[model samples]
Target: MAPYASDDSTTGGEVDEQRSGRRKAARYVVPVTVMGVAAATIGLVPALADSGDPDLPKITAQQLIEKIATSDVQQLSGTVKISTDLGLPDLGGLESSLMSGAAGRGEGGSSADPTAKLTELASGTHTLRVAADGPDKQKLSLLENAAEYSLVHNGKDVWGYDSKSNEVFHGTASESPKHEKGKEQQPPATPKDFAEEALKAADDTTSVTVDGTAQVAGRDAYKLLIKPKQSGTTVGAITVAVDSETGMPLKFTLTPASGGAAVVDAGFTQVSFAKPAASTFDFTPPKGAKVTEEKDAGKGAEKGFGKGFHKGFDKGEARKHAPKSEEGLGKGLGGMKTIGEGWNSIATFDTGGEGVPSGKGGGDLGGFVDSLGDKVTGKFGSGTVFSTRLVNALITDDGKVYVGMVTKDALVKAADAGK
Candidate 1:
């Protein structure tokens, strides 16, 4: 009887201990099971990565481009910052002024800021073209027009058309200078022309790396880094964020090659890529505006020197003796027989003025004057003269031909000749 009781008590104690252990485990098991399910669901449905191949799928440049080319278009509007080597004067101020002026003019429903221009181009409606004085100036004017390329979806097969010059240029993905020149060399077939040209001329490209994920234009995007392959080739490496859903490039940054130093950056906002109307590529020359094919006249003329010479001549005795006439200033200057046919505006001169002595030596006058001619040629192809210089040639911007210079004395002589 004593043994039985002892055994029974021990069994009871063991049963109670087992029950307590099971209760403790039950307390944790429910929460643990829930957590396990949550983790498994996350693993199955992967969250977007920041910028890597695993997080972001690999894509070829051509594939990315095709997506943009074929996407449906709706209205797009946003702000963007473009970077280029062109020397624009106070771009921020210029943008402000343009905005105000456009508001006053009230031309279209368009906004005046360059950021607005990007949206306009992306909209794929009217041709968003820029009319620059010349190519070198055009390069710098990217910001002035808002760092955006006009979109053309019309059936006319124009991608990078220059309506101002009535021309088209095309390009390929191959990295070669032979194809990167301009509309004169490669008539643009589509927006891809601009990208291809830019990539071809890129000094060095880094190993492409895809970062994680982010939102751009309210869409998921993958960031990519393209560093310059060579050292000191560009300011730095450029990183671009492409939309994973639409495959359109969303944001791009250019870091300075010298580590953290950077000169400029550009971005696209409120972006969309879509097929445009059949008329988007259609353009007609303004009734009186002349449309001429662009010619490769080599690098544009240098600035500063030519304008400086003009300023110097203005201060010198030459100003006093310069033949003057009621006709335009160009006519008066053209009256000088020594002045040649291609002379445009004198860019610079060192006249003995104010503090300076008389007959101050002209510094590199030939180069200075020659640059003026080059500028004229660049604008209108080898022969267009500035209106000021046209007075001598008896030529007018309207294509009128004249002879003899319009000198102040010539006016008197003309009066006498008439008499």
Candidate 2:
């Protein structure tokens, strides 16, 4: 099936399906590319497993933090395994919409996109190896069903290929390497960020410390741990595995205060700090593979992708305005206010009515959050609590919504104040 078949008569179902596919693909680049770009500055050291247990260099928490901030070992190749246990509901339908494209959505919808399948494996201990020669050249391959879903970006071209479907999407972009020495970056807060974030703490509200050395992917790593000292926070602690040699982040984990286990755990399962073969950076799609040229994709890289119907959403911007009225929430749950601070911060948005709008229910009961979370009501009245590894949200039956990285107690208090 063709990947992009533009049609003006598209139904809402087809739109949702296409949108779901785009959202899934966009999420892949955020975490993976964010991690790679940091290390790709020096070399790509994906991960190393069960390596020589060399003793980590003796350094104070402050000194270790400094080294992690300055070191750059960008040119390397290794496999990274990303795993998540966010407790999200099964997103099979969402995945189907993505994989089957317009055809799965409604009648006359004919596009078939492999991007849906890409995200389906992004979670759940999925592993892929990365190789880069310089800032302008990088290649990543995701393994699925033993078939390969690969993305190769040389200085000239960026290619996305799905072996299972024998489809290739190619686009050209002028790759420019950012060369800013000692410039700190905070993707998701690396080891050095522990110290940096601590510097902003208000009166012992946050603590940063290195919890000795351990082996990650067989390489020596210092565990930089951050904890919230405030009683209002529901955070357990954030632990980061910093490679001793390259100062690159190898793994990151976040545990909830109500945790029995980690809610968010992402890291490299294997890695190597060695230059990959030159041939590894080269790519040629299998013969007879249907190729789509993106020369007329658009003026910008994103515009090009959009022309091919691979639209991307701005996750960061979306988060800032999530509770707003994009979902026809005109008079309810539009503006969310912040309360507390740091790991203890809570966001509360009031529906300003009796309950959630359920079309015919008229906010009597049930929820708009049901599609987003599990139904759980308590002293704050009936509501649904949508939770992930890091964030938990509570939507009350009284048109009140509370969310935070803090505890359920903090959420409840925020809900009470909204009343």
Candidate 3:
């Protein structure tokens, strides 16, 4: 049930600086984190059990919110299962297309098909084993069929291993080199992390309630229900199951506005609050495996699973084909900005033609993006609007990208307003 560090251990000037930094970081990171997780889990659907609601003392919404906000559990290990059903087309076709392109290039590196790896994650139920001893030591392992992919954070070093590819990625990052633990390192993909992000949206636009108690991971828990009061947002509500004894979040679920079932549901099947073994964070790449090293791994280590793989594995290969405009755009996420606030907030960015395949060797990815959504034309100009059960993304012909959990009409309006 324990995940992510929200330490309020500073005083005076340091406190003010840390708070300011957190606000700025959240503004940029949370939106992309939400959108990226949703996009990746297009077909994932978790299988959660119903053991009946447990009887417990009543608690208010604000109380539950505060409980989660101030949870200080430092160490734990757990198994998380994630399932999402976004009602989008299967990405298997695109995976094949990208893999074919990779093979054609005669690339046999350890991280050959980064896009393909993400597509594979989209289709199935994903089980992750996560352990965290403290802020500086943590581990996340994606349990695949007979194979495991792991990322370990031990002291100043981060290690990633792909068992199937037999490839290892190592990066060195110092914990708050300048600020003395003032910065919050990016947490691994987990329900607790997602719950904390969702909690930030519980402002004037959201209605939060404590909807009784339930048993999660064999522990008695309280259910925190958060609903958006505004329209145009695809998110109907987010349910977070928090442990009763400890304030830690055990599960997080997001349902669509036009709801049938939850679009994304992630929860622990097994959890232990005890500190994980010291050796858990210690890792060594296999003898015959190819190894890639990054001197500054702080940024790359933040991305979860497949994205982290691409950032580390294809770091060299990508630079060759990357456009100069993209090189500049990469500095600040291509002028990315949010147009609104809370549930209906829209994130707009300049793609610099990153999504469109340009060269002769490029495969059917252009066709793939073109196939997903209808061609839309408006005051903002012509573009393609791609949608899933919970998100809508508009890619303009002029290389602008607009994404939100709102309807296509709302997204277009936002785009027009921006233009």
Model 2, span 62-140: residue lDDT tens: 7766776576655667676655555555565553343333112221221113233333442355666666555556676
* Candidate number with greatest lDDT: 3
Each prediction's TM-score against the native?
Answer: 0.32, 0.60, 0.73
Instruction: Count the clashes in each prediction.
Output: 44, 17, 5
Which RMSD does model 1 reach against the true structure?
A: 21.6
Compose the digit string of candidate 1's lDDT tens values, residues 1-419: 24644323323577886876786678798999999999987876554332324345666655554554454323233334444221122335444333333222232222211222232221112222222121111111122223333322222122233333433332112222243233322111122222332344333233544556666555677665554343323234555666677554556554543345333234554444443233433544345433222122111110121121222222211221122211222322332222211111111211222111111222353233233321222222222232221122212122222223232223223223322
Off by over 4 Å in 1: 1-81, 85-205, 229-234, 259-264, 293-419
Q: In model 1, what lDDT does residue 189 have?
A: 16
Candidates in order: C-alpha RMSD to true structure: 21.6, 20.6, 22.3
- Tens-digit lDDT track of model 3 for 1-419: 34536753333597777897787687899889999888767645342345468888888988888887777777889999977676766555554455434322332333422322333443347898988876777787889889887777777777778887888776655533334231133234567766766777778988999988989998999999988899998888889999988888899888988979877788999999898999998888779887766533222232233234333222212211111113212432547677887777877788687633422112465765576678889999988887878777788887888877888999899988988
TM-score rank order: 3, 2, 1
User: Given candidate 3, what's the lDDT at residue 97?
Assistant: 51
Global lDDT of each candidate: 0.33, 0.54, 0.67
The candidate, 1 or 2, that scores higher on lDDT is: 2
Provide the global lDDT of candidate 1 against the true structure.
Answer: 0.33
Ranking by lDDT: 3, 2, 1
- Candidate 1, run of 10 with poorest lDDT: 297-306
Off by over 4 Å in 2: 1-54, 91-122, 171-204, 232-234, 284-339, 346-383, 395-403, 415-419
